[model samples]
Target chain A: MADANAETDLKQTPLHDLHVELGARMVPFAGYSMPVQYKAGIMAEHLHTRSKAGLFDVSHMGQAFLIGPDHETTARALEALTPSSFVELGLGRQRYSVLLNEEGGIIDDLMVTRPVSEEDDGKLMLVVNAARKDIDYAHFRDRLPENVSLQVVEDRALIAVQGPEAVAAVAAHAPKAAELAFMSAASMEFDGIDCHIARAGYTGEDGVEMSVPAGAAEAVARALLADDRVQPIGLGARDSLRLEAGLCLYGHDIDETTSPVEGAITFCMQKRRREEGGFPGDERIQAELKNGPGRVRVGLRLDGKAPAREGAEIALPDGPVIGTVTSGGFAPTVGAPIAMGYLPVEYAGTGTALELIVRGRRLPATVADMPFVPNRYYRKPKS
Target chain B: MTTYYSKDHEWISVEGDIATIGITSYAQEQLGDVVYVELPEAGRNLSQGDEAAVVESVKAASEVYAPIDGEVVEANGVLADEPAKVNADPEGGAWFLKMKVGNSGQLSDLMDQAAYKAYVETL
Candidate 1:
């Protein structure tokens, strides 16, 4: 979330003081004073997490719970707003879904987790982008059934421990957490505070996300960082990690103007949801599902080393502008330049050669399969 | 040999007729990861302060300007596969290119080590 107001008057996270004490380079991001990098710098931080573990303070995200008497009523109300099949989601499991507008464009991408039991009054939890939280809450408040209560959890801080050794790093602090499978979350005790631990992350690695109380966040982060395998990574490394994982940043890759189909995220809509068609933007989304979108998001491999940044115009063989790059940079893992952009469906296939016009020079590029680096998401055995 | 720096943080080490150029360590740190380096082609003539190469990181892309009027004598091919070397050794092994000095007088327009240090402080 990018708050124009807070951009000038930056807010501070629970770890802000810690980051400053550690000599981190703080920059304004998503309405907070965030560390862009540390003394090791971005390159080392990028590779460090790929090889070891990195702890990220993502407290800027919004955490909230939806309570209803039963899961059916709560999930149905949420399904009315998002595109995912939340009702059928098993207990302790989570799904990546999008909140859509009436026209089918995304409001934001969020994670919805089912409650651990039917007795729990709060049956659903939502983690949303920080910048859009206020508006998102207002939308929910107006649309949701009175039976389902939306309670914003303001006293919590979110931290992500990501990489191959993340599980071990975090498990050291909360040993019981070692058994939690990917996308499954549970309320547990850590450092004498109740915390919600989810086996999920943005880096496409085996990791766990902890929603700790504000007071315990710093202690949890410090404990994790105390491990030789874990280091505190900043937003700079976080951006590169997600980019390489082929995940989209909220404002850059998917916004209100881009539909789910156009963003190449139609897989988010379950078959049941597709047939039950009561959701917003159903007509446009279902139509695109059948006929394909006019423009689709795809990855690009620049012919040369020159990076084609966001807003760079993409052209076809005849040099007509077809689309613009949404996100582009050098992929440290790939050893070359990589980009993600929307293009006409005809130009969205793997190996569809194209050109990027930057500064009057047309550099050759080609559509490539995404997750520029292969994803490593952990999934439990299917029973 | 004498070294000179541009405000944009590029540094050039000049000998008799050839000059070796690279980005300052501060520049690399600001850029984060140096993932790709687009070096100028050998024999490409460049004027002082002209954009001669491109340097990209995981988060940003920057243009490396020619330190002085010169013709590219050699480009760093090693960077194509090992661009991280720039982060590892910004001054010595990560030099972007070597060029034949075309107008040595342009060197006077750049800052020396002491001046460059003070310039960085102001930033």
Candidate 2:
């Protein structure tokens, strides 16, 4: 159902030809023609990512650099728009944050990585969701002061090599990448091509994301794929991987009407931001943090193999609807159907019984703890 | 025995009053890697165009419609454990159900093998 013929106006990534050559099933996603899966199929791709390294073409996502006089100036300007402690973010570190509307709802969630060079102190590199990039760019362009500027880097392609073997496999091409600890980044050369590698990924595995010039993207991908442990993965596995990791997908899990507190992303709001309450929607966020959100995001495990897809109603036995599933599917890693959804805080506790109205059938389900598969991020021991 | 295909990619093989039904091979390829299946219960009466079964892949779920009015005779029990057979051989071992035809005339409206093959090319 997903492989509808792409509309003529849909955009294509730099690796479009390469994907087609590899027998990828192309589908229209977020206005771009992307590979949903290759010849190995989604099941095999998902399992391969869990056992080895899987390369993902995330080039459709927006990449940009925020430039200002110094790190303090840029960080302060950004902090005013989002609930994050950017000023305290150390060089080479990456932090996840959400752009919020005045009503305190999420505009989009993004990654902000500080380049690890003294000269690049004033520049903050950002990676925003593909579908929200244009809107996000327009929003930031309208808000930042005259001294600060946003530079959209459309000439670059982003690729993620994820799984347990990702670190060592990537290090084979650029040994400097091995030095990056989790949530960190640095500039490195891949096969003589200048690239930026980050020690982070959306999947629950330890991995590196590389930013390379558009022309060199395919070559970089080939260089990484040449490794025995690496295979080209597609968007199908990407969604399942992130879901099993308990991470939110922008439009599905968190959207403009969903607040961070209710979305279970309160971690993005650090202690300082929570106390000061200066960012957009801070008043309501602070209240929810202290009094507890009216509704909370929780994970669900279905009683059977029938997947409770997005928009399915969650209810008590013969009772009124209490919640709705936001994201759900058969988690290949868990080998069962899993879901994440919003429920009244009362029914959010793990092991709480519930039923999902899937196509008129009242399927039994239970609230469960997330990261259905434990995160396997590699963190270096403190010296 | 004569095989017929519907515009919606369903296929039927009729012998006597009983007709075997399943999705076409093209349909299975589009759905990709079937993970779960929900079949209409045996003995349920279904009208033409009514949903007869549901096939779910990793990304999406599709409803398989009844190509003709019929009374369900049996649903494939094998699919409960081996749904991927739908991908392996959609018109063979992956047949979804069998039914006693209620309207024999409806068979004339469906496409034969040659017609279905040409129809698939346009898709």
Residue A355 alpha-carbon offset, candidate 2, angstroms = 0.5
Name model 1 segments beyond 4 Å from true.
Answer: A1-8, A303-306, A317-319, A358-364, A381-383, B13-20, B41-49, B66-82, B97-109
Report fnat in order of the candidates: 0.79, 0.54
Candidate DockQ scores, in order: 0.45, 0.54
* Every candidate's chain B TM-score: 0.97, 0.98
How well does candidate 2 match the true structure in TM-score terms? 0.98
Q: Which ten residues in a row have the lowest lDDT in candidate 2 chain A?
A: A1-10
**In model 1, how large is the Cα lDDT of residue A185?**
85
Give Cα distance to truth, residue A2, candidate 2, Å.
12
lDDT of 1 by residue, A1-383 (tens): 23556555988888888998877988887778888998887767878888888989999999998888788889999999987898889888888999999999999999889866556744799999988898889989999998998999988899999998998888776876788988898888776678889999998788988999898888898888889999989888898788888888888999998888899887788999988788989999989888999999899999887778889999986579899999887676776778899998987889998999877789999999989888777766788
Best by lDDT: 2
Instruction: Put down candidate 1 lDDT per residue, B1-123, tens digits, no spaces.
Output: 999998989999999999999999989878877777877789899998799888877777788988789899999898987888998899889999999999988889899999999999888
Tell me candidate 2's interface RMSD: 3.3
Candidate 2 lDDT by residue in tens digits, A1-383: 33345455689999998999989988888999899999898888999999999999999999999999999999988898899999999999999999999989999999999889999978999999999999999989999888889999989999999999988898998899889989999999987899999999989999999999999999998888889899999999999999999999999999998899999998899999999989999988999999999999999999898999999999997888999999999899999889999999999999999999999999999999988999999889889
**Looking at candidate 2, what is the lDDT of residue A371?**
89
By DockQ, the best candidate is 2
